[model samples]
Target: MSEGASFRTYFEVEGEDRSRLGAQVGEQRRRVAARLAEIRNVVAVMSGKGGVGKSYLTAALALGLARRLTRGVGVVDADLKSPTVARLLGAAGPLALSPEGVRPALGNENIRVISTDFLLADGRPLRWREPEHERFVWRGALEAGVLREFLADVAWGPLELLVIDLPPGADGVADVAELAPSLKGAVSVTLPTDESYQSVRRAMASAQDAGIRLLGVIENMSGYRCPSCGSTEPLFPGSAGSRLAEDFGVPLLAQVPFSAGAVEVPSGLLDRFLETLA
Candidate 1:
């Protein structure tokens, strides 16, 4: 049989019938199993609220791991409501779909990316009118079957790690906790501000409630360092990284300084990310 024909036959046998409830459950199980088989580590980057630089950190972490480690990495932009990994990585290519499954994501350094942006028509607004609308989008994207298809059916190849950039707040944590039990841990991001700290603490608590391990806390825009004088000043006044780490019993991985170059997505931001990883 042709390669495409062979793939179709395999998919038919493996994928459960969409109409049946039992089949749905089986499909979910298969997808989760497939994800477990493929990726070695799955890290969810989350925050209690938006503007904590969660998505930026997710992209940076994936790139960092991929560039430094021999094993490859994939990033799932689980922030369905506001997917931005595609834009961050500059993946504007059309998604290839076949009877076998969806093709591997196209982006910088072979970083496999899947986001709700890929599913939408050009310029279509994803804003939900009601709570149910939001839930449907979330369920469709992150639930077992769709997630499995993204993982199993796609040509992700072998990955050492898969970093998921979830939507900001408790909703994102709940989504991953409900879907994937293999979540290795979460890296909560926060700014050095009183409000940001309180919000991030709540997010950490949500992860704790879900039994997800807190790998560390990353303090973004913690302080500004003067290149000429070497003087440092708090941009947002608060005890965030160390204090929260002590409270939650997790490490303070790094305090990322307020660098305009660090936050920009394109224009050599990947190189800055590598430095941070180092």
Candidate 2:
């Protein structure tokens, strides 16, 4: 394997012998290590179910960390099919390959982002050019390979933190935990409801099963924010996030609304999470 060979290219190039494939695999692992070596912490934000604002919270966390830490922060949107972190963080367009590796786009607060969103055309869903019938057999494996490239190939600089927005499912959480051994922990995002947390619990359990620590629970859309009075009131019944945290023996780190006007950003939430990283 050449020094320039990357995980992304390993997927692109084909027809290599077994010995060469082994060296390429080793080289790709080295690339992943070199990329992660500069990153201080890796945290995966996940929800077992979708529509929980996981990506929004991921972008918020990435931007917030960049502001507070005064160091680089990067986000990897591992949600290949429906990636939105690029738009959420304002990382737009045409990513070119630098001599170092694939260059990540710049988002707000100078946050670096690598996502499949940029790879797709506008309004185009991720599609494999392979035969439809053959896809069922290899799709999962192919997606997993893409996830590897996202983790290993991008030229992410020295970052104080790297937040990964895992796709909505217990498997996505487990996949990331298995892929990145440097993972510090995982923060489960759930809505304030029994059903929501119940679904989210499977993801938390998956992370734990993969040997990743559970940082805490983030209760998104916990309440409605009164934009006029700047007050927060209950939108859902019961202390759902608290209950979820209790079940997992972890802290309920935050109860955020959907927007500030949508979900209130509580003061010191970022600060508290930072303490956990320390």
Candidate 3:
């Protein structure tokens, strides 16, 4: 009878499809690892949620680290949708292509940088041609593929360190750690607020679970300083970042005051980073 027909699951029906997908992913993974192997160390700067100046912190750390090493630093702006590292560090492109791979742009301190923004011109946004519902269904997978491509194809050369400016949450951290075999540790950025605290705490846990050690915490926009008078006032007043570092058994690396000078990386910052990440 027609009612007696056996049912089959999608996995059973599409076993070959799954194998093909796995092989594709594994190929990309191998490329990424081979590329990253040239870099001496890999670290990620991440935030649990956005609007914590995480991108700025990433650029600052890279610049700081570059000064400490002659080999220089590299950055992969993994925020495929809204990348700021390129603009933040003045890595304008149309990137170059070499026999090795796609060469990353040179930012300040000659920071080797790769970002989607460098591919798009004149502040154009990256959007899928698909409809909203279709984008929702496949955007995550698409973004992951884009990230793997960036990691694998960029000609970073040999670097003292590579800092990844991850988009908010654990997904970016996990992906970078997986792609870059020698990933050392990750720094969490947060504001002093309950929302930031809750999200960043979970993010740090996710990073640790992903096999990347929690190196330290950065409390950005901690206070506002008058550019002219040099007086500091409370901005987002709380102990969220300090408490997070304490709870995670990591150091609160710095309390960055919001000011015109804030864009300038403090010289002592690298000392602190080396002490902690060392």
Q: Which candidate is the best by lDDT?
A: 3
What are the clashing pairs of model 2?
257-263, 258-263, 259-262, 259-263
Model 2 reaches what TM-score against the true structure?
Answer: 0.89
Q: On residues 1-278, what C-alpha lDDT tens digit does candidate 2 reach at each position?
A: 78987565655767766568778877866777778989999999988889988988888788777787876899999999999988888888688798987888998888899888998988999999888886778999899889889878888888899999988999787777667778899888999888887888887887788878889888888788777886888888766689888988987888886454322235567877887777
Please list the residue runs of candidate 1 whose C-alpha ends up more than 4 Å from where it truly belongs after superposition.
1-20, 121-123, 127-153, 225-232, 262-278
Each candidate's lDDT (Cα)? 0.71, 0.83, 0.84
lDDT of 1 by residue, 1-278 (tens): 66665445635676655668777766776666665576777778888878877777777677666666677888887776678887676565577886655665767767888877887767785644446655865655544445555545666666787788877877566667556677778888888888888888998998898788888888887788777786777788887877888999877776777665543333343453344333
TM-score of each: 0.76, 0.89, 0.88
Candidate 2, RMSD to the unseen true structure: 7.8
lDDT of 1: 0.71
| Models ranked on TM-score | 2, 3, 1
- The lDDT of model 2 is 0.83
Query: What is the per-residue lDDT of model 3 for residues 161-256, given as tens digits with 9 covering 90 to 100?
Result: 988899998667887777676889998999988889999999999988887888899898888888788887899868788999899999888888
Q: Which residue runs of candidate 3 sit more than 4 Å off their true CA positions?
A: 1-21, 129-133
